[model samples]
Structure formats: structure tokens, C-alpha cells
Target chain A: MTAPSAPLVFLPGPTALHPRVALETRAALADGFLSESHRSPRFRACLVAMEEALRSLLEIPQDHRILIVGSATEAMERIIEGTVTRRSAHLLNGAFARRLRDVAVNLGREVVEATVPDGQGFPGSPDRFRDPGVDRLLDGAELLAMTQNETSTGVRIPPDLIHALADRAREHGALSVVDLVTGWPSEAVDPARMDCGFFSVQKGFGLPAGLGILVVSPAFVERARERQARGQVTGGYMGIPALAQVADRHETRATPNMLAIRLLAAVAEDYARQGREALDGAVRRRAAVFWNAVVDLPGLTPLVEAGPSRSRTILVVEVAGGSGPLRDRLARRGLLVGDGYGPGKGRHLRVANFPVQTDPMLERLLEGLRNEV
Target chain B: MTAPSAPLVFLPGPTALHPRVALETRAALADGFLSESHRSPRFRACLVAMEEALRSLLEIPQDHRILIVGSATEAMERIIEGTVTRRSAHLLNGAFARRLRDVAVNLGREVVEATVPDGQGFPGSPDRFRDPGVDRLLDGAELLAMTQNETSTGVRIPPDLIHALADRAREHGALSVVDLVTGWPSEAVDPARMDCGFFSVQKGFGLPAGLGILVVSPAFVERARERQARGQVTGGYMGIPALAQVADRHETRATPNMLAIRLLAAVAEDYARQGREALDGAVRRRAAVFWNAVVDLPGLTPLVEAGPSRSRTILVVEVAGGSGPLRDRLARRGLLVGDGYGPGKGRHLRVANFPVQTDPMLERLLEGLRNEV
Candidate 1:
């Protein structure tokens, strides 16, 4: 069977973009997405198609605002700049969570940190309402933010905990924003229970890295509108209200990565035909193949405790020989696994099973590791 | 010769993209540009290739800073936001120039407007510049900005008048920034004499859009650094110093539209091998052929007067029967030209004859116009 083309598989993020994406991009370059007005009827049709597809896939409230922009980082920063006028508590456990703190700090927001040692899940049970540390920070804060999936360490803070957390924030008059870059259906976090959430198109959506999808609560958008009127613009690209205005007309403010959208439309159509449970089942099945292989390897140990609560799309492992030499050897053999992100250096290696990680591909990755480790 | 492919030509702004542009984009989709570091050796190599090629083709100064960004508008906005503070005088005759005023006004900078009625070249002499109307606008303005070719109305401002205007601005301690999107070498305006200039990949380059090339005078960059240190952080993807930092690396700040860059590299190589004069000659010759065939046709009149000062790449024609009916007629005949831009509505139609325009393509445009007009 053509020796199974040397799997140049991606680790979830910067996922494999569909071929249609390129076809449309080529068309866009020739047709010039910006050649027509963003308000044009044809342009509006494109936005409406994507928005409707997104609403069905994510099970988000139809009333929630969807603002597309440059990156998830830009969306997170905008959320901070718009919703949090006073101090806010930032929950940290992995690289993406730390990124939230960094963006908040850059935007001149007063950030209070909630600490969790690496390789650990969110404190205790999902039902546990509040962390004393988070509570102290949220005393006079305007918002509470966290990452639903710490892709760095392969941990998923249970959705029940997130609902409790969001409930607490509401009691304190603070909004809650979540970075769900890799979580989504795997954890089955009901969007009806969250205030806001965002993800980069590269991850779960299987599109290119340039576009970000944001789900902003309508109440928060009201706050963003007020912030915008005051001339307090957070980002050049992620002007929420500006994007909403364009989106209201069924369009995007900038010439969107139309190629990416076309591919997304194709995938969304496929998912709709198959059903969410079927897609989720496929991801789980792929995860199982990888999980079984990792447990069998003598020199490899699963980094995060494997369970339904942990990331089903990502598998973090601690290599017996350590990160430096092992990663180098794997690269020489032409298999690129994720390096330990941020502060998780040398001790951790991440493997992401997202979008279309087939059983054969997972087997190949494990076989490559078995020979090396 | 396969019926010469029907000349499927339009204004080069929406010109057909080379198939390779799409092929490369499809290849890159598997691992999007953001998957790698902007500072990585590979991306650096891409930048070096583009910069070296652009430098040779444009005849730009080695010491000048040339940056690649998302779009031509981004480049235009960057130049103004980076170089001009407090106030700037904008010479407006078409849509593009008016947009510059909008950008300046959006940035909270005071803008002095110097306007000539649409569809007219800068008055026969220098009287317009020395008039009380323009003099009042120039007072205390930090920079003078204008378009090299007002493609909307097919008016090309004389570079000597521009040089004189820049010289005048310099006397008043102001700089000159120009947008040469469709005007590159088809009309000569040495960037070596201006403080800043901007263009895009699509029109004159005969490549796809999505890439903006900005050339900054060394003096302009130095002044920008001084202003940035004073905490003047402008919004938009074109935050000057941030953009310049990425440019300093000779790489893009965000994941670049790599396919566009590869296509642009091919274009630059073709131009370099053919030499600038040959490229410019081809454009002028085609413009001559198209204009010669249609200029005297009934219900059509040239927008810009015939002279060396006219844009060699574009021929703007006022639809003597009014824009609507003529625009519709051309479209029905299977030829598309740009409709009036900004204030030029119902007054003009634009025919672009840039690098991509060929003699045979010119014939098809005339044939279509002949049947309609």
C-alpha cells in the first residue's frame, strides 16, 4: 500500500488543513477577498455559512456573539481589555494559562495568579466551588479566566468544576472566560454553562493557524461596546464590536483566510452528516489506540493520569531517557512529537491526537517510539 | 494555440494567480506557517530570499527598511502611524488618498486635506500646492502624504511635482509618504527621494494579493523609534515599531501568507531577469494599445489628460453615457473593469494595464468595449 507515506503528522495544533483550503486560497488571491466590500451580499453569505455551521457543531447559544479574528491570544487579550476594568484572577497550570497572564499583564490589567504545580489536575473534584487562592484574588476583581484544556500538560479541568467556578465568578459580579483550544467535545463542556470561550482554528477545527473563533457572551459584548466607545481598543484586528457589526451584516472585517473557511465548511458538513457523537467517538477511538501503545512501551510513562477528565485529544508522556536526546533521535527518524511547553522542560513530551489521527497513524508513532525508547 | 485562452483578463488587482501559488498553499496547509517560529532558520531564509529579490527589482536603498505585512492597506497605515504624529497634510484626488486621510483621522491625528476634484490631474501648474487652501493644511503638519497613481480616476501625479512637494515638506520639517500600489515602475517615482512608500503583491507585481511591501527611509525609521519610546502605541496590525522589529528580523511578525511570498519570489525573479525597463515597456505598450483602441470610442472619454504624467499602467475613462449602463454593458460582454472609487462614483471606469496585462489581453478588452460602447 505504498509503504504508508512517512507520516508527517501534526500534534493537533497547526493541524492538517484540508486540500480545499488551498484551492479556495488560490481563488481568493486571484479574486481578492478584499476586492469586494465586506458588506457585500456575497461576503455576508460566507460569514453566515460559517457561523451557522459553528453554532451547530459547538452547541453554543444562538444568542452568543461569534467574533472571528487573528489568533486565540488576540481574543483572550480582548476579553481582558474589554471585560476586566479592575483586577482579575488568572488560573495557571499549563503554557496556555500562563499565556493568559502574560496577555493580561501586557494590556496593563492587574492580574492575580492561581498556582497549580505542573502535571496536576485542577485541585480536587469538579464540584469544588472555589479555590481559596482564586477567591482571595477575585475579591475586587472584574473577571476570572482559565484554560479548559491545558494542552501543555494534557490536563482537562473537569467541566463541572468550570461551571462551579463560573457560578462563583457570577456571584462576585465577575465574568468568566475560557480558552478551549483543545477541550471542546472531548470534555463535553456545555457552552450554555460558560460565560465565554475561544479557540484557534488550527487545533480542533483542522484548519490553518491564522483564524481564531471566539464565543463572546452578549453581556460581555455590551461591555466591549462601552469599552470601544471610550476609545480603549485592545487589538488592531480583534475589535469585537467592529467585528460584530461586520458579522451582523454576515461578514468579517478583514479579508478572512477564505481558504481555511472553505475547508472548515467541508469538515463541518462531514461532521454534521456523521453526528457529533460519531466524530467524538472517532477521536476517542484514536486516543485509545495511542493510549494503549503508550502504556505498553517499557521506557515511557503517561505524564497525566489517564481518565475521562484528562485531554482525550492530547497524550503527554515522560520518556525514560529524558527530553533532549530522545526528542533529537525522534527528529532524526523524522517523527516530530511535541516538546515540553513553557516550564515543563525536559520532564515532559506531548503527543496530540486531533482531527484525523487514524489507528494506523497512532500505531506508527508508537512503533517509532518503541524502537527509540 | 488553443484559442488563446479567451484572454480571461480584468484589472490586474484581481488578476489570475499562478497555479503554483495554490499548490504551495495546499502543501503548507498540512503544517501552517504559525506551526514554526518566526525566528526559525527556515522562515528567515524565506525573508532573506524575498528581501534580496525585492531590493534588486525595486532599486531601493540597501540602508532603507523594507517590510512585508498582511495587505497594502496595512502598509499604508503603518507608514502614517509610524512616521506621522500630531498632524499631516494629505493630497487627495482619488479613493486611495482619501483612505489615507481616514486612517490618519482614525489614529487621532489632525489631518489637513488638500483636495483636487475627482477625475482631474493636479492642476496644469504648481498653483494648487502654493494656494491658500493647501498652505493652511501644511501649517504645522509633520508629513505630506499622497498617491503616486490615483488608479481610481486614472490620474498619475507628476513625480517632479511630488519631488518638489517633498522638498517643500522637508523645508517645513515634514516628510513624504506615498502609496504606489499600482504605480511602481510603470510610472517612475524614485523611493530614494521619499521618506516612505507602500505597494502590494497583486497589481504591478502580477502576483496574488495578501502581501504588502513597505519601504521606509532610514531617517523615517529613526524618527519612528524616538516617537515610540514616548509611548505612542498605535493600534492595528501595523503598529510600526512592532512591525519594524519583525521586519528587522527580515521575517513576518505573524505566520506569513507563505504561498503568496513564493509566487512573489517567482515574479521578482522573472522581472529581474527581464530587467525593469523591459517590464515597464511591456506595461506601457499594452496601455497604449488598449487606450488607442477605446479612447475615441463614442460614450467614452479619457479621465486623465494625455501626457508623460499619466499612469502608464492604468487608463481611466469616464463613461460618457454614465457609469451604470456602461459598466453593465461591459460586464454582459464578459469583460470586467473597476467601477468608480470613493468620490469618483458614476464618473469614471478604470482599466489597469500592469505587469500581467499582455498585448492580446489588451485586444480582448477593446473588443468587449467596442461591442458595448
Candidate 2:
């Protein structure tokens, strides 16, 4: 079936574009700015502005380097290829986290994984490692990987647990990398807590896909350099050293998604004007609205326990019946939410509560659900 | 200084976007299609349409697989990482070709390179290997890589020679890879001639940057699978096997530049309607106009020798009094061209002659050059 003339999309990611960002992108196209050389002063300014805006919006530390890549999956591969010389330890909670472990294995790195059930969130706070099994897996590993917000199951690792895990990895002389794909500004991330972290613009940032932002700590760069020096094969183009070298001059190693980069800068500038506290408060309010609306809906139950472990960005609900009919019903009303991911396919529906979802849109989605259910 | 309100960007790609393609992209954005899930029928139709359009426009053999990637540079890295088991050989003509060698070396592969001065085309016709040195380098190599058109120096390899080189590599049991970055539909590429070929949307296709199109033959896929089976590392997301697997269903490994992909399909469909002979003839006409206008211009000399060696898509000229001032002069007049690439730095200027450069723009550029020089 053909999509409606103008559908209100609320998919988990490749989420709705902020209207202002979309307008700016259209203007960019009209102005022929995409034709400019990546080295041109205008394009370079765009890149610099994006990097600066992200650093400010995310509170990235001075020691960390921000590199724009192709996708979050690409960032995952780069991090594993660059830092993991021998072994990588992964704490897998859902599809995305399991994909990280698979990437490491595909690259022929020795993998140690500690996996929980799909919908279960890791138990712990910032002060300690609650899972002894994961802690043991991190030992002797060159890289420790985790997903801050598991998109597939709507489970978010507590910020305190993330910080504690990075500390533990540091103690064991392993670099820590976190996939913040679905939990960046909305969920509140501190780049200083981890050696490297990545997020895609299509998710919480509310922009089109294509660009992946990778924040690298000095220690991570050093690890990659040491690995390269020791004759280990770090990748090209996405390699840490090459990316770092180009990023020093506010450039990318390859031609990037210039339109997305420009759009991100505009969105980041908006965030700057709105202030972090205000943005965070809006996200919190939206998450509450989403949870309250869906929690008691007939046939729908929250995927993750309602607590610190629930994701603020993506709200996943387990459906008693197959999600296909319900999703089709929503789509018929021009409302779109993500289908179940991986094994959750047809059983769960993922709704994104990004900053771009206006209150009216959220209300409409709720109205549609109420009518359908 | 700030750019003009509407500067006419002539910078060799990301080149100016075709007006129709840009409008199509804007319409797609307005439709909220970018937010659709990659697996959604709407988005899948887009991917399938793009692959089909490209195959039809470029006359790709039925056995070839067309994969969409992030950028041409990423395609280079993937081809090298997947195909080169231990030894790979490169024929270096310009910066981009040297980059292929660097990618191989950076990935810890043994690289053998045959070198020629920049702007110098390989000698001889399609029947024989003109350079014994290059022939020697290809021996015992698992993959032989070359560039169909080097963007750095405006050097285009004759199509017949490209096919002959692939044949030579096949005789040596090595797969061939060609970078048709700036020369594809405009240059009449035959996909059956090479094991694999790649091009970016921004260059020859006259679309926005970000999406790279890679065409691979069954032989290349077999080589990559064999290498993987032999325990050689074959990357993760951009790996040939993964890309091939995803392409079978007309999907990318990750969230791609959906907008660019859509734009490419539209442009390719336009090309399909226009037909190949017509497209090639237009390129030929544009090249003639560009050359005739600049051939007798004072202080400007063509970079490559005239005749079969000259590039039809990009024209490089050496400036006696430095290209910086001339380029700025053109920019102030709302015209832009590429600055010197690689070591050419301040001494040369590059102009793109893609299908998107309208007759009026071409005349305006010629007039601006004549007056300035």
C-alpha cells in the first residue's frame, strides 16, 4: 500500500526530523551549498560549527575528539577494529548490543560476552558493578563495550552504572566504548565517563540519518596508535589515527554527508539556545506523557521495568496480540511506530519520544491508540 | 568572508546538484519518507528502484551486484579489505589511486604499486600492457586496483584499456577493482569489463554527497568469500559479504543517506530516459566546449595531453600566475571551480563538466575565464 500524502512518523529512529532542521536542509540544497568543496571555507565552518555545537550540547570533555562517521554501526566497527587488538568484552542486553559482539567476532577478535534476556535491564548504580558475570568478562579484555540505551528492548543502563563500568574498565587497562545511539542529549550523556561513545543523528537528535557522531577520548586514541604501531590492522578511512588527524583540522577523512552535517549544526545551535536544562526537562516531560499514555492501554505493557532502567528516548511496549494489526491500524491514521526488532518482531511496538514530537502529535498518537484499542 | 547569496558552485563534486534531482529530494523530505523504516515497503522500493535504475543506465551485467555505501572512500576501503587476502597491486596515477594503495597498506596488506607521473595517461591501446612495470606488479597479486578517472589530476583511463587490464588480472587469477568516481554514466562504463566498480553520487551523478554506489561481479564476491573462509579479516558493516547479502533484498547494511539514495534513483531514471548514446554525446559536446573555450586562453594550459588521454568529465588547467587569485575572481562573480588537487596546490584549477552544468552556466564560466585570464 502507498503511504499517505503526509504521514506522521514516530519510528524508533530515522525519526521525525525537526521542522527547522528540515527547512534548513531544504535551504542548503537550494543554495547549492552541497556542491562546495569539503575544504572550502564555508564547508569547513560548517564542520567546525557542528563539532563545537555537539561538544557544548553534550558537555564533551576537552580531552575527547569528536569524529563524524557514516553510521553508528560503522562507529562500532571502527571502535572494535581500532582498539581491540586481541579481545573485546560485551555486555549484551538486546539486538544492538548483540550486534556489537557479532561485529567483534566477525572481525576475528576474541569475544567475551555476558548477555541478559532481551527485555531485562542491567541491575546496578554508578558506584558498583551489579553483574559479577559481566565484571569477570571485562577482565583481560582490551576493549569493554556496552549499550547505554538498548533500542530493541527500551532498556537503559543507569548513568551511574555506565560511569562505574568505565572506571572498572580503566582499572583493568581496557578502553570502554558505549553505544549511545538511542540515548544522547535526551537521556543525558557525559562523554568523560567513557573512553569513546557514539550516537546517530536520526534518533534522539531528530534529524535524517547518514551521519554517526563518534566521541573519542585521548586514551582511546593512544590505544589505537599503540595497536597500529604494533603492526595490528586498524581499518582505513574509519581508522582512529586517520580520523583523528583529519579532525584536528575540523575535517573528515572522506567526503561526509554534508547536508546532514549542516542540519545537525543547525539543530545543535537550537539546542544551545534552548539550554541543556530546558531540553532535558522537555524530554523528561515527554517521556512521562508517553509512559502514562501507554502503561494502562489494553493489550500493551511496558517492555522494561518502570524505573531508572527505562529508556527516556524509546518507549517499547509488548503487545498481547501480534503488533502487525495494531501497527497497521496506527499507520492507517498516518501514525507510524517501529515494529519489533529482531526476535521481538511482530510482538512489540517501539514508539520514539524524541524532542521533535510535538505535544499535539503525541496527543494525536494517544488518541489514535485509544480509538483503536 | 561570507559566501554570496547564491554562489554558482563549480567545485568538482560534491558538484552542483541537478535542479530536478534537488527538487525531487526536497519533495521526498517534505513527504516524511526519510523517517520510514529501512525495511518499510516505501523505502525498499526506493532502494530497489535505485539499483535497477543504475543497472539500466550503466548497462551493468545481470550477474553484478549493486551496493549502496556511505562514500566512495568507504567503498575503496571495503574493496581492499574484502578482496585483498595478502597481496594487492595498485596502478598509481594520481592522489586517489595512491589513496587506494594507502588503504591497502594501512590495513596491513602487502602492497605492490606501479607508478606514473600525475596527469600522464597510461600508454598503448586495449590489446597490450604498455607498461611492463605495471604488468610485473599485477603478478601474484590477489587483487588489481585502478581508477577509471582520477579526480586529482583529471586523468581518465580509456574504457578499452580498463577492460583489457581486467582481463589481464583475470589471467593472473586476481580480481580487478576500478574507481569510476568521476566517470560513470557520463563516460559510458561497461560493468562487465571489471570485477567491481564504484562511483559517488556527488561527482558524475550530479547529486548531493554521502551515498556511494558499488557494483560487484560474482567473481569478486567469490574472492571475498574465499578470503573470509581462509580466515582473513573482511570487515563488518561495509564488508563485501555483508553488503552483498543486504543488497540481495535491496537494502544497505545500516541506515544510509536515504535522501541521496532517492535523488540518485531519480537522476538515474532521467539518464535511462535520455539513453546512453545521448548522454555520452552530451558529455563529448560539453568537453569540446570547455576545451575550445580554454585552449587558447592566455596563461592557461591543459593538464593532460590532448586526444584519447584527455578527460571528458573534468578539465584540469595549469595557471602561470597561480590559480588562487583567478579562482577568487571567479567566485566573486558567482562562479566556483575546484582548487588544485594534491601537490598541484596553488598552480592549477580544476573544472567539472558534468551533465548538470547547463549551457548557460558553461557559457558564463567560459566568458568569466576569458575575461579573467
Candidate number of the best DockQ: 2
Q: What is the TM-score of each candidate against the true structure?
A: 0.85, 0.97
Just chain B of model 1: what TM-score? Answer: 0.88
Per-residue CA lDDT of candidate 2, range A1-373, in tens?
1235577778998888787676897688666678888877889999989888888888888778998788999998899888887899998999999888989998998999877898888766665574666568877899889999999988889777888888888988999999999888765667988899998898888888889989999999989988899988778766988898788888888888999999999998888777777776887787798788887789999888899888877888888988999999999998998998999999998988777777777888999999887
lDDT of 1 by residue, A139-258 (tens): 887778888888788877877888878878878878888888887644566677777888876667655555567887777677777766777543334356666666666676544544
Q: For each candidate, report its DockQ versus the true two-chain complex.
A: 0.23, 0.75
Could you tell me the TM-score of chain A in candidate 2? Answer: 0.96
Candidate 2: Cα lDDT at A132: 68
Q: Least accurate stretch of 10 residues (summed lDDT) in model 1 chain A?
A: A1-10
Clashing pairs in 2: A126-A160
Return the DockQ of model 1.
Answer: 0.23
